[model samples]
Target: MLGMSTTTGHGHGHTHDGINWAERLGHLQAIDALDRDTHADVAQRLAAGLPEGATVVDIGSGAGGMSSAFGRALAAAGGGTVVLVDAVPALLDAATAHVRAEAPAVEVVSVLADAADPALPELVPAGDLVWASGVVHHLPDQQRGVNTLARMVRPGGRLALREGGLATQCLPWDVGIGTPGLQGRLLAARESWFERMRADMPDVVRLPGGWGRALAAAGLGDVTSLGFLVDHPAPASAPARESVVNWLTFMADMAGEWLSEEDRATVARLIDPHDSAFVGNSDDVFVLSASTVHHGTRPVPPA
Candidate 1:
């Protein structure tokens, strides 16, 4: 269910793909809004080792934007095949349209495959590259996701992913370096958002055994991250700063029920509509283990 709606995604139209494409896409789009430069950064990781004419499968290829980028890349090296899979009909349709519109000769195929189904390999045509972003976290069962991803890759193929880790476990939303009296509110906000998320889309946000542990257990190779920033500094990068600001805004929303109108206003000031609070503001990294790219070969029966 890469794009299906769940409490985790605040009711976006997520599909029933084994991975939630909608939720993942929603998040990627959010990141895209600010972290635009990292587009190439991620593509390079996911596309590593892609050879001439290598077939590629994009599991949660929402709106088909990211997968399309890869598909075009494959075509550049050689006429490789691109298969876009998602349980969401809308996403599939859009992906198909994107392929036809952008890179028709690359052999783009769209399928309604759910990652959880053990039969997905049979359902999907084979490929040399397997890629997904922000996918594992949204799966109802992380272990299943690990298994499904492992199963999809052909021998010598790569399965790469970037998932949001529990970077920060409920901290003060506004306790910045210069902000005073933020510690009390930050602590309270952390408690409030945790309760709200648990009450809502607990399935999507809840991590089992942590992302790294789970990915390692899934037997993924080359797993690593940006080391999960506890709190971050506002980089000169606009997108990174925007990401931090948006996070603060979300934290405030999560704590809305527990805060007074005046306190909420303060929270908004820290992360809303404009860029005042962000000038040299110290950002809190969620300890997210950001920028994780994992690849491993799945064993196939000796033919």
Candidate 2:
């Protein structure tokens, strides 16, 4: 969710061409490092109970980070293969390299398919474990997307997703320092865009049980939710600082549409390369956030 502003800026159909996603990806790479241990633990829990040669698929596997986590866990669970699926060709290419580097013993398959497409189930083979993170919100029809993906889960297999609204998946109003409310304004702009997207896609907001309900709607059972917190403290590392700067800069560029005149001025000052309020050189800059994952299993059909 780190580079979300670029794709859904202001949600009013305005695009920020100046946002450098490559740079955002780089920052995300660093931020993800902070959550490595948490992901590994989650992978282990998900890989448990599966036999040797289990098949795992990570839908919308950006940069192959989750793919690498699951690959390593499955490899340790007596070896298995991980298929990394995404709609972007370049992301798949990068994911291939990342998975190969992080999980050399595990086999990797890269597939390009949109998560929202109905044909998504046909393009990929059935698997023992299917995981989708930070992608469901982009789908036009959340229920159809969930059911379509669930169909690819072999009977008795499990389906897991990391899903949440934009407001719950953002940096705090005060990220320890910098312009006191700069991050808040940026998040407001992002939320405005997300609200618009949600309005267009009613299915997203209509999920009564959130991810768990989506799982049940897909005919899955034993659904459960797991929570994880990402807290990056002050005196942030070099990479963290770089990530924070890149994210704020990009958000500031696209905030004009949703942010008020005063808020826009705040964003401009905070993002100005030479200004004292600039986030890049601010000593108090940091990030603290959290997210949740919903896990469910597909019950074996009656004989």
Off by over 4 Å in 1: 1-30, 33-36, 63-65, 89-105, 164-263, 269-289
RMSD of each: 7.4, 6.6
lDDT of each: 0.58, 0.70
Which residue ranges in model 2 land beyond 4 Å of their true spot? 1-24, 165-180, 200-209, 253-255
**Local lDDT at 114 for model 2:** 70
Put down candidate 2 lDDT per residue, 1-303, tens digits, no spaces: 211111210112111222333445655566557568777887888888986888898987767777888988976776777888776656666777787787777777777767776777777767899999877767766777789889989999999888862332234456443445655566778777766766765444344557788899899999998877665566666655666766666666655678777766765666677977666666665666667888788899899
Q: Candidate 1: TM-score?
A: 0.62
Per-residue lDDT over 1-303 for candidate 1, one digit per residue giving the tens place of the 0 to 100 score: 212211111113454322344444444455544433345446555666776777778776667766767766765666677778776666666666766565655777777766555677777766777877666555656677777776777776667666654443323444554445654665577676654544455354345565556656766555544322223333334555555555565556546667766667666666645646442254443322245455555554568
Best by TM-score: 2
Q: Provide the lowest-lDDT 10-residue window in model 1.
A: 2-11
Among these predictions, the greatest lDDT belongs to: 2
